[model samples]
Target: MTEVFSSNSELVLQRSVDINLSDSGSRHEDIRELYQISETCAFITSNNYKKVALQFPDELLVDCVAVSAALEKETNAKTYILGDTTYGSCCVDEVAAEHVGADCIVHYGRSCLSPSRRLPLMYVFGKRPINVQECAAAFRELYPDQESHVIILYDVTYSHAIDDLQRLLGDTYPNVVFSVLRADHSHGHACEPFKVRTNSDCQDDTFVHKFGRRFTLTNFMMTWNRCSFCSFNPDTSTGRAESININKALMKRYYAIERAKDASVVGILVGTLGVANYLNIIEQLKESIRKVGKKSYMFAMGKINVPKLANFLEIDVYVLVACPENSLLDSGEFYRPVVTPFEMETACNKHREWSGEYITDFQDLLPGGSSHVDFTESDHSTNDDTTDVSLITGALRSSCLRSSPEPTDGSSSSSSVVVRNQTLTMANTNAAASFLSGRSWQGLERKLGEAPVVKAVEGKRGIAIAYEEEGTERKDSACPDHKNLNYRKQSGV
Candidate 1:
C-alpha cells in the first residue's frame, strides 16, 4: 500500500514537471526560478503551452521527452488535457505512451462530444469524457488531504465554464478560487491564462467594503474578480482616479491664483482613451475655477472612435477628443501626444498651486492646436514671483512664524523678492511646504525650485535682492513689498 501511494505521488509530480517543462515563457522562467528555491506548484493550460515550451533549451527538451516517456511507461500516469491536442509541445503523448508504452490517455475536446461509434471507441480506448466541473472536482478529490489551491482558468469563449466551476466550488471549499484569464484563444487550442493568484491571507478590507456590498449572491465570485483584479486594481482604475484628483487640485489652485486678479484663460487639454475618462471631472474643475472668478479653458483631444458622450458644457477650453489611428489614417500622419501616467499625475498635482511654466503636450495633438509653450522660455521669466511669494508666505504662515520680510525702504510700492542661489534650498522649501500641507507639490515645484538660478544683473528692469530665510540666502527679481501683486511681472504685467 505504501509503495502504491508513493508511486502515485511520484507520477503526479512527474506530470506536473512535464507540464512545466512543456510550457515555458518569461512568466514560466520566473516560475521555474521560484520552483528551484521553493515548494511551488504550477497550473498551466494549453494556451500558454507554446510560451512554456520555448523556455526550455533544446537539450532540456530531449531530456524532458525521454523522462516523460520513461515515467509514462513505468507508472500508471493518466494524461488528461482539456483542449485540442493537435498543438501544445507536440509528440509528447505519442512518444511517451506508444514508443515507451505508457498506461493511459485522456484528451477532452469538442470532437469527443459526438455520439458516433468512433467517439465511444475513443472514450473507451484512448481518453475519458469529463466536463470542466468534473475535472476540477476530481482534482480536488484527488488531493483531499493536500491543501489544494484551485484556479479555474478560462477565456472569454468558455466564460460559462468559469461560472460553472465557481458554482461548484463555492463556500463548500474555502481554499478554492476562480479567475477569468482574458485572452483570445481560437479553436480550443491549449492556451495559458494570465493568473493573478492572491494569497488567501491577503484580505483587502477596503475592497470588500466597497465592491463586496455590490456583489450579488448569484455572481458574487465573478463580480469579486472583476472588481479586485480587472477594474479597480491600483495599476488600472485607482491610478486613473489619482490622476484626476491631482489635476483637479492643480486646476483649483490655478483658479485661486487667477481669481486674485484676472489672468488669461489657460486651456486644459486631456488625451483620449485612458485619459478621456477625466473629461467630465476636468469640466467640473473649470466650473469650480469659474465660480472663483477665474477665466479658464478646457480641450479634450483623442481619436474620433472615443465615446461621443464625453462632451462637456460651459467649458471655455476647446476639446479635440478623437482617435490617433483615425487621425493618422485620414491625414497620412499619426499625430497624438502620449503622456505617461506618471506625468499626468504630476501635472494634476502641481498645476494649480505651484507657479511655473505649465504646459501639457497633449494639447498639441488637437486639430488646429498650437504647440505647448516651452518650459525653458516660460520658467526664465520673472512671472512666478508672486506665486513663489505666496508659496513661501503660506509655508511661513502655517508654521505660525511670519517669514514675510519688512519693506527695506519702508515703501509699499517696492516689491519684496525671495531668492536662493542653490536649487537645493528651493527644493527643501518646496518639500517642506508639501510636507506641511500634507499634499505633494507635483513635479512643477520640484523642477522649478531645482532649476539653476540666474542672478539678476545690475540696472535690470526688475528688483534684485538676496534674503535670509531658514538659514539660506535666497535671491529674487521681484520687489520686496510686491507681495500683493496679482500676476508675476514677467507675464506682461
Candidate 2:
C-alpha cells in the first residue's frame, strides 16, 4: 500500500513478555508462590466448584497454562484461562466467566479490589520483589519527622513485602500505618473488610477516617479533613526516588468540578460493566443532573479514547463511571473535561460539602459507603440561587432557578426553570432540549408522511481521495483547468 493508505493498515497482534523464566526447581516453586496456587486450590476444593475461570492479563498469559494445570491437579476442577478482558483487567471479567458457567473466578495479577456482585472471586496478586530495608530508608528520608502522620499504600505486587515494611518501621514511626490486602472472598461480602482501616479504641480526636485509610494531622485549623496524597517516583538520573505531589492533581480535579457545574450537557461514560452497582450509579447520576437543572447522556463505548468521545460534540463535560484505578482519566487529551462520580456529586448535590478528600471509587458515593455524605432528595427542592465567577472561563456563573407561573388550580409545576447566560430567557429545565434548539444542525428532520420515500442507489465508486471516473480519466483531460499545467503533467496531481 502507498503512504496515503498506510493510516488504514492494522498492526499484527503479538503477546510480549518482560519476565524471564528458566527450567529450575526454585523457579517452579516461585511460580506456585507467585500465583498463589496452594491457597487457590484450597479455596476451590472447599467451595466444591466444578468449573472455575482463571483470569490473566496479556503480560501474564505465558504461565496461564501451567497455573491452570496445577489448580486442576489439586482441586479436581476444570479450569479456563481468560485473557484480553472486555474492559480494564483490574475488575473481574464476570461476563466472560458467566459464558463458561464458571462456579467462581480466580483473578490473577493486579486488581482494583472492587466487589463482584454476580460471581464469587479470588485474587492472586503475582508477587514482585521489593527491598524492605530500602523502602524503610526511603520512608525515613522523605518523612524526617518521626511523628509525621503517614499511611503507606502500595501496589498489589508489593503486598507481600508490606508486612516486612511495617515491622521495620513500626517502632520508629508509631504514626506510620501500612495497608493490607484481603485475598479470600468465597463468602458474598468480598469488599466489606477492605473499606476502611481505623482504630476504634484510639481516643484521639485529631485522626480522621476516609478513603479507606485512617491518619491524623498535627494542625486541624487549615480546612475540613484536608489531606495531601503523595506517591514515590523513581529518579533515574540520581538512582534515587522522590515523592510526587498530588496536591496539583487534586486542584485540577477541583477545576474539573467547576467546569462540570458550568456545563449545560453532561455525558456519563460507562467505562465498566463488571463493576458492582455501576448501573445504579449511572441512574443516580442522571437523576442528580436533572435535579441540578442540567442534562445527562449515558454512553457505553468500551475502552474510551479521544476520537470516540470527540464525536459527541454537544457534551460539555463527562463523568466516567469506571474502576478506581481507571476512574481518573487524563482529560488533557480530550476535548472536554472528565470528572469522577465524587466530583459529579459535589457539583450537583447542593447538600454535599467539599472537604478536599478525593474519592476514585464510585461505590464510596453510594449509600452505606464510607464517603456517602449526608444528603436527601428533598434538599434539591429548596432554591439556593447563587452566582460566582468561573475559574475556567472567567465568566459569571449563575444558578438562578425559578418555577413557571401557578396554574388556575393554585398548584405549582415541579419542573424547575434555570437561566442561561447567553439567552437570558426562561428556558425549560431540560438542558439537552435547550442545547439542541441552539445548534445549527438538529439531526434528520422528521417530516414523516409529507416527504416521499426514495430508493437507495450507488454513488461513489472509489475512495474519497480518487473517485472511479476521476481515476480512469485521461492524464491530459485531468489537468484541463489546472493553474500549473506542467506540474500536473509531471506528478499527475
Candidate 3:
C-alpha cells in the first residue's frame, strides 16, 4: 500500500510484518500504507550509480537526487553521495533541501549521458558561503573592541606572512596597535617586551638582546587582534642593576674571606644572568687577591655567556651551568658546581667574611705609608701551647659532630665545606648529612690528616675564629671563642 501527497505536506511510513503470509487481507493493508508513503516521498535505489534505475511512479526521487548532487558540485566544487542508501532510504536529504526551498536539480552523473561535461550546479548545497559570511559578520559585531592591541604570535612557518599582515592592518587602521612575534619551537614567543613597547616608550634592552635578530615588524596599526597583547612594560634594567649591586656586595664579602685565609684559590660561582655585573667585582678583587699571592677562580652557571666573558678575561675555567633539575660535573675539568642563585649568594658572603683578616692586612699595606710589622715573630712563641690546644680541641669537636647522610642517587652533593683558622668551623656538615649517615669526622682519619689547625683573632669588628693550614687561614665570625693555631702548623701563607 502507498500514498502520495504535496511536497509541502509531511509523510510518515510504518510497516507491520505477519507470520502468516497466507493472510491476504492484512498483507493488502500493509502494502496500501507503504504505497501511500512512497507516493509522496519517492523511493530511489540507495546505491549511487543505481539511484536512477529504481524510481517511484511519480519519478520525483530521480529529479531530487540529481538536483542535490549538481548543487554540491557547482557551489562547493565537491561531490556528495545521494539516493535511498545515502539518505537512509527515506529521501531525507532531498526533503531537507526542499524544505529550504532550493530549486534546480542538475543530475551530473551517468543520467546526463556526457559524464565528462561538468556544469555549474547551484542550489541548496551552495548556501554554505552565504552562511559563513553571516557568521563572520556576527563575530565582528560581538568583538568590536578586540582591535585595541593586535599581536600576531605565529610559528616560524607563518613568520613570512607576519610582515604582510602587519602592513595590511596598518594601512587599514592607523590608530590600532599592531605587532608580530615569530615563536621559536617552544611555542611561547617572548612577547613581554612587545606588550610594553606597544603601550609606552621605554625600550627593553634585555628583550632586545634575547630576540632582536629574530624579531620582525611592519607598519604599525591599531585595529587588528591577531595576537596576544598586554599593556605592561617589560623593561628589566632596574632589576638587572639591582642584581649587579647584590653581586658586588657578595664579591666584597668573598674577598675578605680569601684575604683572611691567604688562600690562593678563590672559587666564585656566578649565576648566568648575574655574570656581567659580577665580572667587574671579580676583576677588582682579582688584583687584591694577587697582591696577597692568591689566585681567583670564577665559575659561571645558568643561561650566561661564559665563553665570551672568559675570552675577554683570559680565564681558563668557563663552565656552562646546567639546568638545576639535572646537573653533574662530568669530569671536573672545569668548576661545574651545581649551585642555585641563593646558594651562590650565601657562599659568596661566607667566603668573604671567612678571609677578612688577610683583607685587612692587605689594606694596611696600601700607599698610606705604614711600617711593615711581622706579626708571626714575637707573638708565635708566647701562645704556642695554648694555640696548639685550641687547634686540637676545635678539630676534635668538628670531627665528633655528626650529620645524617642524604640518599646517594648519583646526584651532585649539596654540601659545602666550612673552616675557620684555629676554630671548629662547620663545613660541609649539612652537605655531608645529605649524603651519608652514622658518620663522624673521628672515623675519617684520612680527613683528619688533611684538616688544618683553627685560629681565633681580635679585629676591629670583633673576635672571630679562623682555620689555619700550612700557608693559609680561614676565619668564621660565628665561632669567635675558638683559639688561634700556632703559626708553624696553621699558616695559609
Candidate 4:
C-alpha cells in the first residue's frame, strides 16, 4: 500500500511518465525556455523565501516538475508543485500554499489579479509570442481617421506583443496614443478601465486613457481581440480593429437575463477558488436568490465545460461566479442561459433595472460594499418549473403566495398546491426562502490592519471597528456611526 496521508489532499496518479529533461530534443528546448525563468529565480533568491509553491495551469503543467526542480536548484528554495486547484487557477491557492507552509506562491500562467489574503504572490505570465508587427500594421491601416486615442488592452501573456507594438507604432503615428494595460495589483480592490490623462510634459493636448477589460469587436471599421491580439471586422468580412455599439452590447446582456428570468431552478456555478473571499460572495448570492424567492443550488467545479453542466438538466439557468476574465460565459451554445451574478441579480430582482451598465468584477457585488446597488424583492410568482419564481411573484410570496402559470402536464387546476394531488418542492416559495436564507462561515483572510476588531459597547448593540484604540472616538448608540448596523450580530431581526 502507498503512503497517502489525508483523503482530502491525496495525490491521485493517473499514469507515470519517465523522461530525462536533458535527453529530450524539442521537449528540452520547450521546457528550458519556460517564460521568465531568470527573473523568477532571481526574485526567489533575492527574497530568500525558503519554501515556495509553484502553481501551474493544465496548459503549462507539461514542465511542472522540471521547472519546480530547476527553481529548487537555482534558488535553493523548497518547491511544491500545485497542479489541482480548488477553484480557478487565475486566483492564488491559499489552501494549497498553507498545506505546505509555503513562504510565497510562484504562480504560472494566467492570473485574475485577485487579492491574496494569506500567501504573498509572484505572477509569471508565460510569454506567448504574437505577430506584433502585423497587428501594428493592421491597426495603422484599418483605424478610422476620426478616432485618435487607441488604448490597447490585452492579457498579461501577450505583454511581449504590446511592448513590440508600442515600439513599431511610435515611428509613423506619433500622435496616436497607446497604453499597455496593466492589471490592478492593489490588494482588496478592482481597478477601473479608463483614465483620461493630460500630461503637461507633452507639447500636444491629446488625452490618454488605460483599459484593462476585453470586448468583442464587430460590424465596424476595426475590431480587436484582447487575448489573441487579432483585430477583425466581422460585418465587412475584413479584419482590422473592433467597433463596439454600446447600446447593442448592453441590450444583448440584458436580453440574456430576460431568458434567465424565465428559468425555475437556477444553478450558482463556483468559478474561482483562488480569489480571496469567494465563499463570502457565494453566501451573498444564495441570500439574493432567497430574497427573490427562488431555488438556488451551487456547483463547485474546477473547469466549466458544456458536457459537465448538461448533467443538471433540472437547472434552467447558471450564474457563474468567476474572475473578471472567465465569468461572463457565452450561453448561445449552452443548453440554457449562463450569466454572471450581476446579471443573475438583474434577472431575479424586480426592482433592479438593467440600464446598460454591467459589472464583471464580483467584488462590486459584495454585500457590504459602500456603493452596493440595493435590489428590492419581486412580487411576481410563477408555478412553472422552468421560470424563476421571483419574476412571477414580484416578491408577493411573503406568506400567502399564488402562481399563475399552468402545470406542464395539462393540469386543469390552476391552484399552486397540485395538479392531481402532486406536491412540488418549489411550490412553497416561503419554505424554499427559509431554507436558502442562512450564511455559512468559511474562514476569512484579512490583514492585521484591515481585520475588524470587536469592542463591547455599554448601552447598545456590540460594535466592531477596523482600528481599535482607547483614545480614538468610540462609536456609541447616539453616535452617527451607530446608524450602520452589523447585520451579522442580528439574531433573526
Best lDDT among the predictions, by candidate number: 2
CA error at residue 225 for candidate 3, angstroms: 20
**Candidate 3 local lDDT, 1-493, one digit each (tens):** 1122222223224442233232222233342232222321222212122222121112233243444443333333222333332211211223323332323122211110111111112111100001223322332333345443333332222233334444544554443443443223221111111232364532221111111111121101111212222221122111111012333443443433222232224444443221112344344344333333333456543233223343222222222222221111222222222222222222222222222121111112223424122212232232122211122124311101112235466543333543445667766323223323543432434445456666745432322332343334545577655554433343432
**TM-scores of the candidates in the order shown:** 0.20, 0.70, 0.19, 0.58
lDDT of each: 0.29, 0.68, 0.28, 0.59
Residue 481, candidate 1: alpha-carbon lDDT: 49
Per-residue lDDT over 300-390 for candidate 1, one digit per residue giving the tens place of the 0 to 100 score: 4322321221232222222232222111111111122222211222222232334422323233422243522211223223222222223
User: In angstroms, how far off is 400's CA in candidate 4?
Assistant: 9.9
Candidates 2 and 3 compared: the better one by TM-score is: 2
Q: What is the C-alpha RMSD of each candidate to the true structure, in Å?
A: 26.9, 10.0, 34.8, 22.6
The total of clashing pairs for model 2 equals 0
lDDT of 1: 0.29
Candidate 2 per-residue C-alpha lDDT over 328-416 given as tens digits, one digit per residue, 9 for 90 to 100: 77788787888989999998776787776667778878888887864454433455566778877999977644333356545444434
